[model samples]
Target: MAQNGTAESGATEERPALPLPRPVTVQEIRHTKVSERSTGARLCSCSSSVSSVRLQLCSFYKFGIKCQFRQKSKARTNTWCSPQMFIDNEWRTSSRGRTFPTFNPATGVKICDVQEADKEDVDQAVAAARAAQQRGSPWRGMDSSSRGRLLHRLADLLERDRLLLATLETLDTGKPFLQSFFVDLEGSIKTLRYYAGWADKIHGKSMPIDESFMCITKHEPVGVCGAIIPWNFPLLMFMWKIAPALSCGNTVVIKPAEQTPLTALHVGSLIKEAEFPPGVVNIVPGFGSTAGAAIASHKDIDKVAFTGSTEVGQLITEAAAKSNLKRVTLELGGKNPCIVFADCDLQMAVEEIQKGAFYNQGQCCTAASRVFVEETIYEEFVHRSIENAKKIVIGDPLDPQTSHGPQIDRQQFDKIMDLIESGKKEGARLEYGGRAVGEKSLFIQPTIFSSVKDHMRIASEEIFGPVQCIFSFKSQKEAIERANNSQYGLVSAVFTASMDRALSVSAALETGTVWINCYNALHTQTPFGGYKMSGNGRELGEYALAEYSEVKTVTIKLSETI
Candidate 1:
C-alpha cells in the first residue's frame, strides 16, 4: 500500500480499495468516547471475512487490532459547537436565543443542547446561501475543477474525522458503533468522493438544427438549495443532499432532524476546515414544523430535497407550491417487499431478508417489511429467520459486539410496541421475539410474525422498527400480486435460482428498484427512488445531479451560412 491511500504493486498484500486509511477493527480506533479503554491487540492475520457491515475492516486486515472490547467509557468529545448554528462558515447562537436538548437514545440521557432554528434562523441561513451563490461570489465564480478539488478536500477531512463522526452518530442515534463506523461512515465518504469526481464532468450538449441556426442545452445550478434530512441515517442523508448540490455549483441551507444532529454539526465544522467559501453550506438544526416549514416556503431557496414520511412529503410539496414553486425531490416512506420462491437458496434468502428487515433497527425507508414466500417452503424459511434473529446481541450501542440498539426515543418505541400488539390482534402467528428487551431504555426484541395477512395493520403500515411479517403465497402470480399490493413502490427483491424467474418477476414488480436474489443492496453509483406514492425523484448516482440543476436552451441564428 502507498502512504497517501493509493495502490502500489509488488507489496504482496491484498486489501479492499478505500479513499483513506482505516484501522483494522473497532478496537483499533484510538478515541476515548463511547468505546472504553483500549488494550493492545495483534495485527490482522488476514482471516477476517469481509461482509457488507464491515466495509472499513476489509482494508488491510493483516494489521490486526485484536478482538475489540470495552473497559470504561468517558464523556463525549467533538470538534464543533453544539449549542450554536453553523452559518457563513462560523458558529453563531440562534437569533431567537432558544436551545433544545438532544438525547442519547441508548441510555435515555441528554447528550447536549443544540441551537433551535425556527423561521428567524432559517431566514439567516437562506440569506447566507443566496449571498454565496451570487454571480460575483467566491463559490459561484470558482472554476469547476477547483470546485471538485474542494469536494476532494472535504472528503479527506471527513475521513480524518471519521472516528469522531462515528462516535457522535452512535451517541445520538443509538445505532451500534460498528454500524455507525463501517456502514454509515463509509457510505458517506464514498458518496462525497463519487460526487467530487462528477463536479467537473457535468456538461451540456449541442443540439442538431438547421445550418443557419445553432442550438445548445446547458445544465445550470438551481441557485440556493434547501435540504431537510431525516434522523435514521443522519450523516448519510446529510451528504446525499449536499454532495450533488455542491458539485452542481449550488449553495445549500440544510436542516438536519432535531432528533439526531450531532454528526451533522460536526460535519459543519468540517466544511469550514475543507476551506469551502463562507455561506456555501449552512446547517440549522430544528424541528420540521419550524425550520423545515420555513425552508419549504422560502422563495429565495431555488430547490428543496427532503427525506421522511409520505405525509410530511405532502406537506413540503404543498408549502413549496404555495410559495415560489421551487423545484423539489422527495425520498419518503416505504413498506417494501421480498419474494422468496421455493427453488431459491433458502439460507441466503433468510439471511438477506432478515438483514434488510432488521439493519439499523429497521428504521430504513427501504426496509423489507413485507415478505411473500412460496407456500411449500414458507414454514421452513420462517424457522430459519427466527433462528437468525436470535443471534443479534442487543445492548449498549458503544459495545462493538452489540449488533442491535435501542429505538430513537420513547415515541418510536411505543409505536413499534403498538404495531406488534396490532399484529397479534389481527391473528398473525407470533413466531418469535416480541415486546421490549430491557427497562428504561428503548430496546425492542427482534420480532417476527408469520401467517401474516396483507390487510393486517402491521403488514400494511410502515412500522419503521425491527419487525418482520411473512406472508405465504400459493403461486408465482399470487406472490407478485401480493408484493405489489401496497401503497408504496420503493424497492423489492425476488429470490430464485432461475434467472428467468428473477428477470420476469423483477420486471413485473411495480417498485422503482429490484434486487434479483439480494435485498437492500445500494450503491452510490446507482440511482435509488420510488415508483408510486413512495415519492418522486431519485438520490445517488448521475440521476441525483439532475435534481439540483436546471436545463436552459440556447439558440442563435447564424448571420450567414459558414
Candidate 2:
C-alpha cells in the first residue's frame, strides 16, 4: 500500500496506505452565514472491522472522514459517509443534532444518515438567503452577465459529473441509472445552461405613454425564494427551481425531499466549487412538516415553489398565505389520460403509452395514468399493454437492462398495492401484475387494470406507481369528456392520425399540455404545469422566469422632472 498524500499532524506512525483518498463528510464544511455549530457529539462512525492502520492524510482529509478497507472479495470499499444539510455555504446538522437514515429503495439498505433540518435549521437557511437577497449584497450586486457566467460554470461542472450525479440519483430514488443519466441528468444540465443564457437576457420593456410622461416596466427577481423539490426527479427538480431563480438574481433556500437527498447534497458541493457567493444557494434535507413548512411560512421568504402531491401543494399554498403572502408555484399531481383512437398506429401507441405510464415506475406527475381507447381497438390495446407490462425488467437500478425498480419507499409501495386491490374489488379486470414481486425491497409488479371505469378509485386517483388504467369509449367527444372527468389537469395525450380530431381533442382536453401521438415530450422551450388542482404556475420555458420575477412599472414625467 502506497501513501497518496501528505500525513496530518499528530500521526504517531505511518502504516498501510489507502488506495484512494477518503472523501470528506458534510460535518467538516464551514463557511458563510449559517455558521458551523455542532452538538459536540459523534453521532455516527465509519470504521473497518479489520486491524486498522493509519495512513498519510489525503487531500480530502477532514472531520467525520470514513475509513477505507480492503475486502476479501478483492475490492476496496468505504463505510457510508453521512450526509449533512447545506445551509448558507457550509454543511451542518440540524440545530438539535438530529438525523434520519436514507435508504436505497432498490435494496432496502440504509445508505447513510442524512442531516434532518428542523425548524431551527430551516430558519438559518432562510435567514442566509434573505441576507443574500438584501440590497448591496454580493449576490444582488452582481451583474446579469456575471450571474450568467457563474450559472454556465455550474452547468459545466454538472456536465463533468453527470455520471456521478446519475449514480447517486439512482441509488437514492431507485430510478434506472440509464434514465437518470440520459434523461434526468441531461435535462438538469440543459436546464442550467438554458437559464444561464437567460440570465443576461432578462430584460425590461419601454412603453410609449402620454406626451408628458415616459413609462417602462422591468422584471426583477423575487427575493429569497424557498424551493421544495420532490423525490421523484431529485436533481432535475432542483435545477428547475434554482436555475431560473438564481438567473433572475434571487437567493434560494432549497428543501430536497427527505427520501432522496443524496444528489441534492452532492450538487451542494458543486455549488461551492462554482464559487457561488456565500448564502446564495442553500440545500436543506428534511420532512415536509418541519423544513418544508418552515420555508413556506417563513416571513422573510418572498416565494415558495413546490413540486409534489396536490395535497401537499395545498398545504404549501396555505402556509404561504398565512405568512407573507409569498408567491407560490406548484407543479402537482396528475391523473393524466391518453386517448388512443382507431386511426392511430397500434404499435407506436402501445410503445409510447407504456413509456408514458411506466417511465420512472409511473412516479411522474404527468404520467398518462388513465388511457381511453376507441372501442374498436380497446381489446388490442389492452393485450399489448399487458404484454408490455410483463416485459418491464424488475431488478437493480444499476443494471441498465432493468427498466423498473422499487418504489421510492415502503409507504408508496403499500399505497400502490392498496390501489391495485381497490381496482380489482371495483370490478376492473387485472389484466396483468397487481402485487409486489419480491419481499426484499419495495419492488411492485407492473400492473394493468382494464375495464376501469371513470369513477373507480384506480382511475380517478393518482396511484403514482407502475399501474395503468384502461377505459374504452365510442366517440371523440366521449373520450374528451371521460378524460376531463378528474380534478387533475396536469398533462394528457392523444394518439390519432386524423388532423382535425387531434386538433379538436387537444383543444378540448382540460390539461396544461396535450400531446398528439407522443407522451412525456418535455423540453426547456415548452412550458409545463397543470390547469386545475394539479398545480399552479408553469415550470419550464420562459414562463418559468415569471414565477421568480416581479414586474415594476416606472413612469417619468418629462416636463415635471426636477
Candidate 3:
C-alpha cells in the first residue's frame, strides 16, 4: 500500500500519513473568539499569531504529543459546561453509585463522567414521572396555555444558549460545529417552538352518533414515557421526543446513549431554568444494557419511544411487549437508497449523494447509504463521488474548516473498518477511502465502493459510517427492485429530471420518506419515520405529539324530548 504522508516516531503504525495540526491552546482559542466577536467577552486570548498555521501544525503531530500539549494548555481541556441528572425536582446521582466516562470524539479523550443509572435509578425515574402524571402534579393540572408558555420559555433558553449547546454537541458527537449550530441546534429550537404552539391547540373531533346519542373524542397524555436516544444527533433526538411529549402533558425519563451524554445532561439544566417542574423531565445517562433496557421494560412507563439500530429496536419492542405491553414507538435503522437517472443533473446528484452518505460521519439513520445509478451515469457518478470524498477535510470537529470528523468512538471506528473489509472481501471494487485516518482519534476516511452487487452486505446492511456503496441498474424497474430489497426502509432519495419518473419511482419505493431532487432534507413540520424493520410510529410535526397522547371517547344521550 502507498502512504500519503510520513508518520512521526512512536505514533501508531496504522495511523494515516496525513499531516496533523498542532495542539490548540485555550488562550489562543479565546483570542480567536475575541477577534471574531466584537464584544468584550473577557476571553483569555492566546499569544499565537496565526490560527491556521497553529491548526496545521497540530494536525500533523502524534497523539501522545497532542495529549501532552492539551495537558499543558488550558485551551485543550474540557471547558464546556454540562448539568447533572434531575429527578423528582432534585439534581441527583444514580442510587447504585455508578458512572461512565463521556469522551470527546474529536480527540478520543474523556471529557467528563456522567452518572450511569442502574435498574434502581430507572425505577426511581419512572416513579417520579408517574407521580408527575397524577392530578396534583404541576404538569397535570396546568392549563394547556400554561404548558405552551413553559415550552416557549424553554425554547427561549435554548436560543439564548445556542452557541454553548452547539459547541458541546460538536465536541461530544464529532459533528462539525457550524453544522450543529445551524442545523441541529436551530432545528431543535424551531421544533420546540412549533410543538409549543400545539400545546393548547391539540383537539379531537366530535363524531355524529345515532339519533338519541352524541359521541365526542379527546386526546390525553399517555402518562409516563421512556425515551431512548442514540448517539448521533443526541440533543436533537432528545428535543424530537421530549418537546412533543412535554407539550402533550406527558412526563418523560430520557436515556441518552452512553457515547454522547453531555448535551442531554445540559438540557436538563435548561429545563430547570425554563421553570419546568423537576419530575416533568428527567435525564438518565447510562449503558444500553442497564439504563436503556430498564426504561424499555419498565412497568410504570406508559409508552416507550426509541431511536437506534434495528437490532436494538427489536429488543426494545419485545421487552416492552413482555412488560405490560407498553405503547412503543421506534425509529430504527435505515438503508436508504439514492437513485440517479441518466437525465438527471449529474453534478447536483453527486453533491446530494456526497452529503447524504457522509454528513455527520454517516451516523444518521436516514443517510443515503445505497446508491443505484442508471448504467449511463454509474461510472461518472462513482468517479466524481471518489474525487469529492478525497477533498473532504477529516480532523478535529472543533475546527470550523474541517468538513468531516472522527466517528463516535473506537468501537464504531472498528465496526466501520470491519464492514469495509467485508465489502472488499465480497468482491466489491473499493473506489476510494477504505481506511482509517488519524492514529489516535477514531477517524475513518469517507469511503466509496463501486461495482457493488445488491446482495453485498455493504449494500443491504446499514454500515452507519461514511461509506457509500454504488450499484448500476439498466432500468427504473431494476432500480426500484434494488432499493426495496433491503429489509430496512426509513428514507430514500431520487434525482431525475423527469417528474413522472420521479413520482413513479418514489411511489414504488418502500421507504416512508422519499425525497426527489434532494437528499436528507428535513423539517419540524413534516412527519418522519420508517416502514418495515425501520421501526414503527412517526415523529416531528403534530404527528409526533399524537404519539405521546392517547384517545378517550365520550358518549352522551340526547334528551328524550328531542
Candidate 4:
C-alpha cells in the first residue's frame, strides 16, 4: 500500500529570504545588478540580529556603483500583444475593421487584441491559395527536395526561437511553460522534421500490365488546402496540418482559433523568413462563424483538414458537402478509456492517470478521462488516485514549479464546473477535488468521481476537463463491453501484468490507438485518428502526406509486342 503523505513529503522547499546590502524600492529591484569584489577587498561580516543594518548595507552596495535599477510605475494591466493576420502576400486585418480581445486565463487579463476576420478575409486567403496553385506560382513546379529544404529551415528557426515561442504560448493559452516548451514545441519540431524527411521520399508505384501495354502512376498535390486548427495545441496542431500539406506541394489557407492566435501569427513571420513563396501559406485569425465557415465552404478550396469538437466537425462536414464537396479530414472529440488491472504497477498507473487526466487540464481529446479498474484493486486504486490528485500544484503557468494551470478561458472553466455539478446531481460520488483553487486564475482542482456507472454523463460524454470517472469491473468481458460502450473511439489504454490480457483487452477496444501500460503517448512517426464518431482520416506519418495528394494512373498502348 502507498503511504498517505508519500507525495507531499517530497514537496519543493521554499528558498530562504536574502537581505540585500541596501534598502531599495520595488522599482529598483527590476534593474538591480551585482559585481565581483576586487582581489584585495576585505569581506564584511554582520550579525544575524542586525536585520535592518544588513538591508541598509545591501542598499549601499546597490546604489554605490553604476547599477541597473527598476523605477516604480503604474501597473501595466490590460496590456495586449496584437499581431496582424497574414493573408495573400500581405499582413492585413478584416475588411470590416473588427477585433476580439484574447485573455490570459491565469490572471483573467487581456493578453492581446486579435483581428476578427470576416468573409472578405477568408475569400481573399482562399483566392491567394488558388492563385498559388496555378502553373506560374512558385509552389507549382517546385521539386520535392527544394520543398523539404524549406520545411527543414523552418524547423531550425523554430528551435532557435523556442523560448520566445514557449513564452508566447504560455501567455496566450495559459499552459505551463515547461509543458509548452518541451512537449508542444518539441513535438512541433519533430513533426516538421519528420514531414520534411518524407517530402522527397514520396512516390507512386507503377502498376504492372500486359506486355503490350505501358502503365504509370503518380501522386500530385491536392492544391488549395483549408486548415482549421483548434486552440488547445494551437501551434502544434497547426504544424501537424500545415507542415505535411505544404511539404507535399499544396498551398494552405489556415484559420487559427481566435483565443490563441499569437503563435500562429508568429509562425507567419517565420514563414516569411523561410522565404516560402507568397500565397503558398496564408493565415487568417478570427471567429469560427465567419473565417472558419468561409474557409470550409469556399468553392476554391480543394480540401479541408480540421481538429476540434465533434459538433463543429459535423458542421464543417455539412458545409463542405453543401458547397463544393471538398475533400475533408477531421480529427474530432474523444471520450478515451484507461483500464487498470489488479496485477498492474499501482505507482506507475497512478502517475499515468494523473498525467492523462490533468495534463493540459484534460483539454486533450486523447486524455484518459475514464478509468475501469479490476474489482480486486478498485478501492486501493481509487485511494491512490485521490492522493496523487491532491499533490498536483495548480497556479500561474509562468511559474516553472506549477504542474497544472487554468483552463483556456472563463467559458471553459464554467462549463467544466457545470459538468462536475451534474455528475454529483446524477449520483456519482465526488471522490476528490471539485472546486476552483486560485482567486485571480480559473484553475480547477483535479477532480475524481467514484462509483460512476458506464451510462452516466460523466462517463459517457466528453467533459474535456480534469475529471476522472472510475468504474469497477468484475471480469475482462465486462471491462471490454464497458470500454466499447462509448460513442467515441479515439484512444484507449490498458495496464496489466499479463501480456495476453493486455493485448486481448486492447484488441477489443474500439479506439484507433491503444496503449498498453501507458496513456496519451504520441509520436510524429505514428498515424493518429479515431474510429466511429471520433472523426475521419489520420494526421502525422506518411498517411498524412497522402491526405494532401491525389493518386493518378496513366496508361499507354505499346506499338509492338516484345
Candidate 5:
C-alpha cells in the first residue's frame, strides 16, 4: 500500500512529437513537467503499492515482470501512435477514407485524427478474421503451444512498450498517469500472460462410454469473435477480450470505443511488432452505431463480447439475435453498493469505498455509487469519506502529482453534473464536492451526497461518475434490502469484522461478486461478470476460456469383435 502524504521532487521530460501521416488541425500535445511520482496511488504503504487497491496482491502475482516496472518511465521516443485501422496485420485508412479527431479529455484539446471505421471497415475486419480462422488457414493450423508463445510474445511487447501505452492511455482517457502506468498497463500485461499460459492448456477430453463406442468431447474455437470494448479501461479491456479469445485459437474483430482509441491503436502497432499472424487480432476504432453495430449484426462473426452500458448491451444482443443468433457476452454497467456495518473498520471502509467511487473519475461500470451504512456509523463514514475525497488532486492526466483526472468527454461531464444537480433537486444533501472542477477540461470534483433515498435518481440510476450517495440503514436486513434494490447486480461489498454477518450478507446479496471489507479489488484469476441487468458471461480466469470455446462431441463405433 502507498502512503497518503503528498510530495514534490525535481525535473521531468516529455516525448517529442511524432510526425503525423496526414495534415489536420492538431493541438500541440501538451505534456507538463512535474516531480517524479511513485507509480502507486498514495493510499497505502505496502511494498507493491503500484498494483493499485488489489489489497493482497503485493507483486504482479509472480508473473516475473517485476523488474520491468521501473521507477519512472516516460513515453517512448518514437513515431506517433498511428490512428490507422489494423486489419490483416497491416495498418490502413478506412474504406471510406474518412477520419475523426480524438481529443485529450484533460485539456479538451484535439490529440490527433483517427481513421473513422464504419460498416464497410467492419466488414473488411470481419472478413479478415473469418478467413484467418478458417479450416486450412495458418492461424487454425498452428500448434497450441506455438499460439501460446505468440501470446507471450505479445505480452512481452506490451511490457517493453509500457511507457508508451500508459502515456497514450492517460493522454486519451484523462486517467492519472500513475494509474495508467501501474494499474491499467500492469493489469493488461498480467492478463495477457495469464491467458497465454492457458493457451496450450485448453484442450479436449475423452470420456468413458459403452464398450461398443467411444465418446470424445472437443473444445473448439468459436471462430471470429466480435469485441466491442468500453472506454474507461481501454488497454485493460482490449487485452481482456483478445487475450482469452485469441488464447482459445479464435480470431477477433475489436471495435474500441471512439472516445479513447489511442491506446488500442498503439497496441495494434505492438501486435504488428510481435509478429502475430494476419487477421489474428484487428482493431477498428469508431462510434457504436457504426463499428459496434456492425460487429454485433455481422452474420459472419460467430460471437460478440461487449462491455458498456446496459442499453447498449441490449441493442447489441438484439442485433446478434437478429443476425444468425451469434453468441453474445456482455459486461455492462453497475450501480454497485458498499455496505458498511457498525462492527467494521471505519477508516478502511471509508477509504476503500471512496477509492472505488472516484477511481477512473467514477466512470467505471462498477463504481461504488451507492453506500448503505449502519445508522450508528453513517455520520462518521460520510465525514471521513468527504475528507478523503478532498485529497484527490484533479488536474492534467500527465501531471504525476495529480491523482484523479478528467471524465472521458464533455458529454459525460455534463451527464455527471446533471445527475449531481438532480441529487440536489431530489432532496439529497450535498455533503461535499458536486460540480465541475477545472474550467477547460472535463474534470469534476469527487462529489458526495448524504441522506439519500432509494427512489432518488442518484441512488437508482448508474451515475458513472465521481458522485457517491450515502444512505443510512437501521439493521442488517434493511441494509441488505436497500443495497439489493438496484437494477444492476454487478458487484457489492459487506464491510464488517464479524465473519457471520459478512458471510450471511454476502450470500444474500443479489450480486455476481461480493467482497468482505473491500471494494473493486479484482484479480486476473477471478471470474468477473454480473447477474440480472448487469449482463452475463465471465471475463477472466478459467471461465472466460469457455466464452470463446465451443463443445464438439464425437462418437466412434468400436468393432463388434472387441
Candidate 6:
C-alpha cells in the first residue's frame, strides 16, 4: 500500500485532505527566488498560509518550466512537471525551437510546455539511432550482459523515482494516481526487469547437415528501430517497445504520444543517468502527423513498432511500404466484447466487468465496450452492473478516493458524448448516466445502455469512454456470433463457471486474447496483440523478441575449409 492512503489492491479509499488548492487571487502569494540552474534558468518558489496551494517557476531566456505545488501536509506533491525531449542521449528542445502545451485532463489546465519534434528533429534522432547500430559503435559492440546491466540500472532508477513518475503520468493523462503508480509504473518495472533477464538468454540454433557440412543460424539485432507509442498508457507503451528492442541489442528512436509525454521525458532522464550509450534510445515528443509519420517512413529505420488507432496503423503500414520497406509491428485499437453466461458468479462478473469498462476512464483499447449477457440473467446482470457503475468514484485523479478521472482532452470527450447521443437516437435504453459531469473538467458520467441492438453504433464502434452497452443473447452460439461481428479482434472476455464452456467459447472467439473468467488481465509473461483489423504483431513475452531481430543462416563444408 502507498502512504497516500491507496489500497494495495488498488481500491479507492478515503483520506484526509492536505493540499488541495483553493481558487485564489494574485495577493495570496508572490513568487520568491530560490536559485539558478547551470542552464541559466531562474527557479521561483512561493508559499502561502492563506491556502495550501504554492507555485514554482523555472524561467530561462529561451525556455521555461512552470509547475503547481501542493502538499500532503508533510509530503510534497507536484502538480505540473518540466517536459523535454531526449535525443542523442541529451535533453534538448526542438530544432525549430517550437513547443506545445499539454494539460491536466482532470483539471482542464495546461500543466507544462513540451518540445515539439518536426521532420528535422526526427531525422536527427533516426540518424543517431542508425549511427549507434553501426558496427563497432558502443551499443553494437556491447555484450548482451552489458546491455542487460544498463536496462536493470534504468529499472532501479524508475523504482526509485516511482512516485514522481506516477504523479507526472496522473497529472498528464488523468488516470488515478494509485493506478498509475501500482499498475502502469509497476508493469513498466516488471517488464524492463523481465526483458533484462532475457538479454543474455536470447539464443540461436545449430544443425549438422549430412555429416560433411555444418549449418548454424544467428539471431542478430534489427538495426535502428522506430517506436511510436500511444497516450492511453504512455510509460507502459514506451517500455513495451524499448525494453524488447534493447534486450535484442537494437538501437531505437521512440516518439511518445504528444498528449502524454511528461512521464516518457522523465524516464528519458533516467535513461541518461543509467548511462546508456548515446543514440541507444531517443525520445521524441510530437504529434502523430509529423514525428510519428517521419518514423514510419524513414528509409534508414530498419524496423517500426507502433501502438495507436487502427487508422493510423494503416497509415504507418502504407508509409513503410512506400519507403525502404521497413519491418513493421503494430498494436492498434479494439472494440472488445465481454459475454456473461447465466452460470457465472453474479457478483464477481458485475465487479470485474465494471473494471473492464470503466478502468482508466474506459480509455483502454481492450476495454469491454460491448457486453452481452445470457437472456435468462439479462435483467439481473443489467441491474447489478448499473449498481456497480454507480459506486465508481469520479473526480480529480490525484484524489485517493477517485476511481475515475476525466477523458484525455476535449476531442475525446466530444467523441464519447457523440457516441452516447447516437446510442439514444438508435433506441438503446439508457439505464443510467449519459451526460457530461460539469463544465469544468472533461469528466463523463459512467454510462450504461441496456436493450442495445447488435447493429447499433454503440455496440459495433469502439466507444473509448466509460460507457457500457448491454445486449441479450439466447444461446452460447449466439453470444459467440455477436461478439465476432465487429471488425476488431483485439480481445474479448467470458464469465462462466463451466470449464468445458470456458474452453469451448475461448477457442471459438475471433480475438487475439481471451479471458475465461476475468477481464483486462495483462501480464508481462503473456503475449499480447490483436487479429485482423485490430492490429499486427505481438508485444510481450519471448515472441516479441522476434519483431526486433533478424535471422541469418551460415553453412560450412569441412573439406572445403581444410
Count of clashes, each model:
4, 0, 13, 10, 5, 0
Worst-scoring 10-residue span by lDDT in model 1: 35-44
Q: Model 3: per-residue lDDT, tens digit, 102-156?
A: 7778776666566678888888888888888999877899999999999899889
Error of 1 at 552 (Å): 1.1
* Candidate 4 lDDT: 0.81
Q: Each candidate: what lDDT?
A: 0.84, 0.83, 0.81, 0.81, 0.82, 0.83
Of candidate 3, the 10-residue stretch with the lowest lDDT total is 52-61
Q: Is candidate 3 or candidate 6 better by TM-score?
A: 6
Q: Model 5: which residue pairs collide?
A: 1-44, 1-45, 1-46, 2-44, 2-45
TM-score of every model?
0.87, 0.87, 0.86, 0.86, 0.86, 0.87
lDDT (10s digit) by residue, model 5, range 1-562: 1233323343344447864221111212212122114211111123331333211112211211122322254522222322577787666677888778888787776766778899999998988898899998899999988889998998897886677667678777888878888899889999999999998998788988889889999999999999999989998999999999999999999989898887787677566656678888888999999889989999999999999999999999999999999999999989899889998999999999998999999989889998999999888998998888888887767767788988888888889899999999999999999977756667788999999999899999998999999999998888888888878999999899999989999999999999898888899999999999999999999999999999999999988835
Q: Which segments of candidate 4 are over 4 A away from where they belong? A: 1-81
Q: Which candidate leads in lDDT?
A: 1
lDDT (Cα, tens digit) per residue for candidate 2, span 308-381 = 99999999999999988999999999999999999999989999988998999989998879999999999999
How well does candidate 6 match the true structure in TM-score terms? 0.87
Estimate the TM-score for candidate 2.
0.87
RMSD (CA, Å), candidate 4 to true, equals: 12.2
In terms of lDDT, which candidate is stronger, 1 or 3? 1
Query: Is candidate 2 or 3 superior in lDDT?
Result: 2
